[model samples]
Target: MRRARRTSGKAQRREVRRLAAASADPALHFLLLLPLALLHLSGRAHADLAAYGLVEALLRRLGPAAGWLLAAGLMAGLLWAIGRIRRRRLAWRGGLLLAAFEGVLWGLLLGPLLQLCLRLVSLPVAPLSVPGSAGALHGILAVAAGAGLYEELLFRAALLSACAALFARLPGLRGRDRLLSLGLAVLVTAALFSAAHALGDPQALEGPVFVYRFLAGGLLGVLYLARGLAVVAYAHATYDAVVMLWSSPA
Candidate 1:
């Protein structure tokens, strides 16, 4: 009995380590984000309607079945590419659970942090508004999920990667220069993220909201760099969900 318990404890510890390591893999991030993106693209949410209009238009052009098939293939290719590039095997189930836990943890932290930031800046913190109706609540949740997935996919994964690559190509960049280049890439991507919000809703740019978003974007960017895409994506989603729930009228 003692031997068995010892073996089981060792196994549990090893599994925990594996799961924690797997959570940092970008391939896992892609896998987690894909489903949310699909849900959003399926025309269920009003929040991303304008931003994802091009995707919606493309899907309409292709028709439902064909569009879904295309999206699946593209997502598969992306997963394959990320796995191949990283040369890492996935621990999908464990990674997913860790991602969820990380998101919830970060969500809890973000509210207090945001309030502190606002207080420091002497800005009045405004409550996020969400519709009280059941249907609208569902749509808002979908939008929050979509924002968590797609925004991180675009800003952190795609834009940050592109910027880093571009910066790496600059002649005479080496050592600390390369590090500085990557740092700059992160900042630029965060700024773009804040700016993109305003593109869809100009009202978001008003008052302290823009500053709040910019600060949030910067924090997310740093989190992405430190904790990988899955952590930040889910954190963003979880934070939005909490805010929406709090704002919804009783």
Candidate 2:
């Protein structure tokens, strides 16, 4: 009995270590966010309109079968890379809990702090226009959720990765140089994220709103690097949901 208990304890410790590592893996982040991405795609959410535009355009040009094939190939490639990098089994339950905690943290803390800062800077932040009808509310919620999944995928996963790769090619970039490269990548990506919003509607790109978005984007970019994609994705979604559902209308 004593021997059996000792073996079991060792196994439990190993499992815990595996879970902790898997929780931080980028591949696990993609897998966990996959269902939300599918939901967003199915719901036809407008919040991610700019994010999905290029893919949608490609699909239209290539036709459904080819488009699907391309998408599948991309996903398979990503999964393959992830598998190569992170061979351990994922801790789905732990990841889910962490995502929820991050969401709450954003909703209750970081988001409010940003808003307060905006107010102090004399930039009147506009409330998201929540629709009066239930159907519209549901639609808006879907868009908000989609925004979380797609925006993070584009900005953090794709843009940040691409920028990092580009930065890695710079000569004499080692150690702190690498860190500086990543910092620059984050700033550039954050700037693009802020700018992407204005592309949809030029009039919405007022001084205050632009500044607010730029700051918000920078914060999210920093969070992405610090906390990994899953936490930041859910955090973005939760922040938007709280703002839309509870805050006064614009």
Candidate 3:
């Protein structure tokens, strides 16, 4: 009996740790996302890069070593924040794994996949643009940091939390109803996320692209639920980084 009780207690503690790491206010998450949104909206500055057609300029300024250092520092900050809340150590291995899966795998590959799917339905592809070598590398690093961390914070943490909170308030929701409400939240937020991207580039998708956004948003939402902000942020950042990197001339 004692052994059984200990196992149960240990399982409960583990669950608690996971939940704590994943929790964040939806609004604050959105606030973290402001810089990227602003960067996107900043016409002159954005146009400067677009006009230069240099993918590597900013990256050159930082240099490879320095750019990596910056990435490491940002990752550390993210882990530190997670630790403070959950009292869990984000091991280097786990960090790397998160970076590999979310940052590299999803960001780059998903875009193309979605594009292919959209083609079937007659949606045109958005031409990939990148900075010069120096700028491209650095831009990717910075974007990975900003977009990955901030967007996840906004959509997954703030948006999800708000929806969940709002849903929870209705007394009639219980069990299955509560689950349905949460699903509704995910759907609504996913639509908003898709809309946000559509605003950035109208011609970026077709029928398949819409499906892609929906799936990606849902994937992020689920990741937010399963792994917390850090994992999703890593994935988001990685995705942008790849897009920036791949878009650049080799």
Instruction: Report the candidate with higher TM-score, 2 versus 3.
Output: 2
- What is candidate 1's TM-score against the reference? 0.76
Candidate 2's C-alpha runs over 4 A off are 1-18, 45-48, 70-87, 119-135, 171-176, 247-250
Task: Give the TM-score of each candidate.
Answer: 0.76, 0.74, 0.53
Candidate 3 per-residue C-alpha lDDT over 153-216 given as tens digits, one digit per residue, 9 for 90 to 100: 6677788879977877766765456677778778888777665655445643555555667666
Ordered by TM-score, highest first, the candidates read: 1, 2, 3
Between candidates 1 and 3, name the one with more favorable lDDT. Answer: 1
Per-residue lDDT tens digits for candidate 2, residues 111-215, read 677778788888887532222221455655566667777788899889987997788777766544677888888888978887778766574467766677767
Q: Could you tell which candidate, 1 or 3, scores higher by TM-score?
A: 1
Task: Please give the distance, in angstroms, between residue 29's alpha carbon in candidate 3 and its true position after superposition.
Answer: 13
For every model in order, what is the number of clashing pairs? 0, 0, 25
Root-mean-square deviation of Cα positions for candidate 3 versus the true structure, in angstroms: 10.2
Model 2: residue 21 alpha-carbon error in angstroms: 2.3
Worst 10 residues of 1 by lDDT: 126-135
- How accurate locally is residue 193 in candidate 2, as Cα lDDT from 0 to 100? 80
Model 1 off-target regions past 4 Å? 1-12, 38-45, 57-69, 72-90, 126-135, 171-177
